[model samples]
Target: MTTDRQISDQRVALVTGGTSGIGLAIAQRLRDDGLRVAVLDLDREEARAVANDAAFLFVGADLSRRADCRAAVDAVTGAFGRLDVLVNNAGFQHIDPIVDFPEDTWDAMLHVMLTAPFLLSKYAWAHLAASGQGRIVNVASIHAQVASPFKSAYISAKHGLIGLTRTQALEGADAGLTANAICPAYVRTPLVTRQIADQARTRGISEADVEQQVMLEPAAIKRLLDPVDVAALASYVVSPAAWGMTGAVLDLDLGWTAR
Candidate 1:
């Protein structure tokens, strides 16, 4: 029931940090949507351990390294022969007061959260352009639009990512490629679970209080976000119906930004 043209028109998606958590959820969702999914992460074994068998490829590459970013893109295009969607979802967070924030930590956060997306976008541009329906979705944070104490580097890098997303949108418009960002708040992921503990210790609060009084304090909804929720949103955003929705910064913040 398929022709060669239809086969060549098949969509392929590459998700960074796709080994687990939000990244994995997105990859699985895209795969279920009938797209060839490629997961780029740091460890091949870890990637395989959590990767869906339906996924098209698992590439081991550190996003924080520019060479690795290029290589990951190359590997995906090599394996799939084309790239249609890019989910820039690889990231980690470090929480610390500005005065105590380590310079190296800041640099590392920027490298992974901000610079990596740019590098990946750069390398994937040509292939994405050729797809005629290329989609670039950056997983930014609520901090991209707001400030929180003890998260100087995280907030800064997220803000920069938003800027990059907007610029990509402008540049990719002529090429049928679209760029957008999803800004989530307090998602229940390994990175956020670790932050819950770190923030508790730093603020001298119980972990429960940290989640209640601090993490969900600004939101209308008081619960942490589910990875599947974000993944669902990602699916919609990258679909053909969302072609008109480029350059938008969508908030999955449980009304945190509404306040």
Candidate 2:
């Protein structure tokens, strides 16, 4: 158990899928913010190679597995003595029409993107509440608010994530925990880069046309956002100043929803 004085002196954070892209950025940002950061990813060796920082703790786990999720929370708290922030940022995209979508793929996507977060939160609840300023930041997408074709699984999972975030917020209010979701437009990550080819194939268009015509068409800004753009927002969401910002679905959508 962590003492109140220890909690106030040093906070710890765990970021899922923290080896690359948005998760890596958020992990780095939290580490820089003076928090002891732990990264949970599927590939332990890959994560160890990417997060080569002495200060950052790296734990590998397949979030799609319930056992892994429980063990992951245990690993973090066991190593750091407490968990103050949880960033559910691990996700992937599969672009295919519903008729052609693989049932297994849908299950796998939901397992990683939606169910994993719930399991992590359930296992980490006590440790988080103990910190007395726990924060849960879900890296949802603009798809949570509106949908795009050929991304049924991703959009559905994101929509469900928001619901989970809200429920967590309500339950954690008295425990001094806050849950919020960050809904951003398309971001420049390996996940989005991979989608270029997938989108081109699904839409029967040139790969060059995917970014402008498919990805950025809905956003008024018409550009992919950097991972750091999200990291900055997440940094704020987990900060001491954001205590009152619970159950908020924050849109860093580049005006995608403005219209």
Candidate 3:
């Protein structure tokens, strides 16, 4: 457990889309590392429970809306007094073939995954600039570097996020804030569970086959990533040791691209 002094001495981290899944893991990991943690999410109850008895604040809001993003950042900075780490990890899979894809869904995906990061970074930039040890870790996917069929919107959003991560890292260099993107292969999350079912229906294959043929085929490990693994990487990137690692995409992709 983090003592009061430890909390005061440690940096403050804002983990977006952190109510559950990978974001939840990242928030908990940082809290364990003695950082004051604030989670931005739509799930008020879940967020509170995740950080219960810890130095955590749950800011309930949707990040896809620009105003909501700004308000969330302000709330976090207000409560913590400074912003040290920003993890933009709130997003979902919206799989569809472009011809029949819903425009509304596409818009939602882009806004949530891409635009929201930009807004949160915008709102947090000044505070981060002042901190001199600020960090931003974007949860971009392996799709940020590679692509698959029937995942147009999701892929595009992840790619755009990589661009955001790079540009922000460069801009923050002189100020000592480091920004980097984590490109992970398929993680075993509820979000990916939904993707499995969707892939089953779309490919007219069993969900089991979706695992064997789709998700695992590209990875050298042939297994789903654990949320903790991704969280640990995010934790490291925000540490002082990662100061020189800005504008980089840290791949936890099980050597998927190596092949």
Candidate 4:
């Protein structure tokens, strides 16, 4: 356990999408782990509320915009003075076949899920390297590895995120920085909850059927994963104990890929 004095000198971490779901859980867990935590989200009021409740530094930025991404990083560094860890956990879902998928939706999804991480990583590179044990954890999904129908944008963004993770890992190696991605199966979050309905409509099934037949059908474990499940793994990934774990794509898939 880190002593109080040590925690006073603790590193700072930034979590994107930290207003809710897996991102929120990871931010809380990192705070519990003695790090100074900053949360970046699109909703300013919600971000402020959560930050106040958790005693965290919060910034709101629509990650789909390049200027917003840059400003978010600047806000974190300005508030915390340095950034030691980054968790790219902001994303959303859109259920539609490729033909029906909106072009604007595709562009927005890529911008937020894929391009935002790239830009944030680019901007935070120097401060992270200065930390001397910098860590970057990309909250990818099992969709990054295997694809289901009607999720082209999400799957594409996640797959690209893994590629970004690898590149960051390689570039950060000499600087004592590390980057890794956690590929989880369906997690219980507002995002996934909303997906249940969208998926049901998309597949012409009832909402109840969507969870069992569609979401968990591929999983060996027939249960939705709590946000804390991902948070716990994230805590480990960003810790000093995981220094050798760069360039890795970790699976929290509940055996979905085993088949």
For candidate 4, write residues 120-234 as lDDT tens digits.
9999999999988999999999999999999999999999999999999999999999999999999989878887988798899998799889889999998889999999999
Q: How displaced is residue 242 in candidate 2, in Å?
A: 0.5
lDDT of 1 by residue, 16-77 (tens): 98878899899989988888889888877657766646445888888777789989999989
List where candidate 3 sits over 4 angstroms from the true fold: 1-6, 51-55, 197-207
Best by TM-score: 4
lDDT of each: 0.89, 0.91, 0.89, 0.93
Evaluation by lDDT, superior candidate among 2 and 4: 4
Each prediction's TM-score versus the true structure: 0.93, 0.92, 0.92, 0.94
Backbone clash numbers for all candidates listed: 0, 0, 0, 0
Task: Count residue pairs with overlapping backbones in model 2.
Answer: 0
Residue 31, candidate 3: C-alpha displacement in angstroms: 0.6
Error of 3 at 128 (Å): 0.9
Q: Per-residue CA lDDT of candidate 2, range 185-215, in tens?
A: 9888987888788769889999778988877
Ranking by TM-score: 4, 1, 3, 2
Residue-level lDDT tens digits of model 3 in 1-259:
8576765667989998787889989998998887888988885675677656555788888877889999998898887788889999999876668998999999999999999999999999998888899999999999999999888999999999999999999899999999999999989898888889988998999998998798899888978989999999998999988898999998999999998
- Local distance difference test, candidate 1: 0.89
